[model samples]
Target: MSEANTALSDERIKNTSRLRTALIRPELGGICGTIIVFALFLIFAGDSGMFNSQGVMNWSIVSAQFMIIAVGACMLMIAGEFDLSVGSMIGFAGMMIAIFTVTLEWPVWQAILVTFALCIAIGALSGYIVVRTGLPSFIVTLAFLFILRGFTIYLPQLIERRTIIGGIDDAAEGDWLAGLFGGKIFGGLFQWLGDNGIIATFERGTRAGDPVVDGIPMLIVWAIGLVIVGHFILVRTRFGNWIFAAGGDAQAARYTGVPVNRVKILMFMFTAFCATVFATCQVMEFGSAGADRGLLKEFEAIIAVVIGGALLTGGYGSVIGAALGALIFGVVQQGLFFAGVESSLFRVFLGLILLFAVILNTYIRRLITGER
Candidate 1:
């Protein structure tokens, strides 16, 4: 009898171990995808300068752009909400900044600050409508998507008589606040590397010996900073617990005094903040803003978040995984160009990956809930 009991106990332990492994399987999807992307790109584009300093910078910047938005989307999705207006918000914010500085002749810093405030307020309003009306966030944000995009195009044409605005760089010259978004970091380090023959340097002309890559852009910095802060909040705080609770089961969370409405609203505002950050960095880097900027970026952000292992039903995800998903996007998008592949194939890849992620997440959810 005692021997029989021991056998049963051992079997239960093994089953528990298997269950734990299954629980974590979905979260590893992003990490595995990132590794595979890097390996493939290295094999196909290794000799194409895709791994060089400048090439790395190119992909890194693109990844950072994705990462900035992914962070917000991940958090919001984990809280059981969607923000489809993010892409439109980016265009709207950039256009507003251009209009403020160039057309209105306002100070660059003032324009940027005001744009951020307006964007955040709009985000809050979106959240308010959702919480108060009990409408799905998807529908609510989708409405704002069109509304904001329309303004993005119409405002520029109405004021400047064109859809594209310029003169931002000139207006922002010597502006202290603009530097935070537009400036680069670690220039001396890169210069040293070039001087010591570490990185490629220009060999001819008045700029001879200058490093091919100068420094890290502020966009990358913002990406890393947001990721760190987001990860910390999601993994380490009472508020984080509330977020998960709010998304997992709003009714139950409210029973426990979780303030579900407040959490959701705040998350919407954060999503807007992230989108504006991307916009400011982009406009600064390009020295101009267009109505067409950030087209389809909202879907890209959602795809990245899904690839990062967040359940469509909400309450499960990792910020680190989302960052990895964004990295995969950056690599594959740039890798196609370097490998001489057609660019349009990227959309096909996105569709396939998103479908796979959704299927995997569904399976994981069933496992956790003991559903067939």
Candidate 2:
């Protein structure tokens, strides 16, 4: 009887392991999505510039914003918290930077420092409320989203009686910021792409094709660097283990001396820091971050993280997967444009993709938790 039981146990363990291997492989799903996207473009808009040089750069330039924010949101989600106010935070930080640098005539670095300090305070307050009250992060962050959003538009409008804030002095006018954040330097890379004879149609075969211009936007590089750093902290270090433990079972982690509250605080701070970085990028891209600079951006970040295979309930996710998910997102958006789909209708398509991603994520999640 004992021998028979041991054999059954071993069989079950093997099955469980196999299930995990599949569930954790979101990068595989990402590859499938890539193929699907590429094929759709080829069939529907084969004549579009998507196969060209400059057309490729368009998406890379646009996607840097989404990819960077998505990477940070992924880390926060994996740590078992959420930040709905990120979009508002962006506008607020940008507006504040303008106010300090332009309206108040402060130096750029000083304005940035103040903005960082403010973001940290807000993050700390949010974390304190969530951890102490045991309220849902959704509810707490939802309130913040509204408060910050209102302040962003109304405060400026109340003072100026207009929705826009212009006429401010350009405190730092040497074009240094733009050169660093918005320039391109991959002439050699684009030459390599065309020489490969892989595909060409869009861009008029324009020269700036490497899919990332200005020598790979500073923001994307920062996001990638963050991924490496976050991955290191999560896997090669002790803090990562604690994050998994805390998210997996808060009560148990506390009993194990995991410093759960401190972790929660730090996660919030990380998100706020990301918001500040996003604001800086927006300024570099547009020369200004308006009161309405980042509308619905927070939702987009959350969607990217979820699509990257993070669990809705927390405890499992991959930063690299989220980065890949962001790439898929950028491609689809640009693909629709290249394929001649109405730009206004792109959101509906995005909604469908998110739905599909979530469904896949949920099913895989069920298999892992033994609920399916």
Best by lDDT: 1
Give the least accurate 10-residue stretch of model 1, judged by summed lDDT: 7-16
| Model 2 Cα lDDT, one tens digit per residue, 256-301 | 8999888887888888888878887666556665788888889888
Runs in model 1 lying further than 4 Å from the true structure: 1-14, 18-26
- Per-residue lDDT value at 65 in model 2: 72
lDDT of 1 by residue, 1-372 (tens): 788776655544434675567567545889889988999988989999999998999999999999999999999999999999999999999999999999999999999999999999999999999999999999999999999999999999999999999989988889999999999999999999999999999999998989989999999999999999999999899999988998899999999999999999999999999999999999999999999999999999998999989987788888898999899888999999999999999889889989998898887778778788
**Every model's TM-score:** 0.95, 0.84
**Which candidate ranks first by TM-score, i.e. highest?**
1
Counting clashing residue pairs in each candidate, in order, gives: 0, 7
- Please list the residue runs of candidate 2 whose C-alpha ends up more than 4 Å from where it truly belongs after superposition: 1-12, 15-20, 158-161, 166-170, 174-214
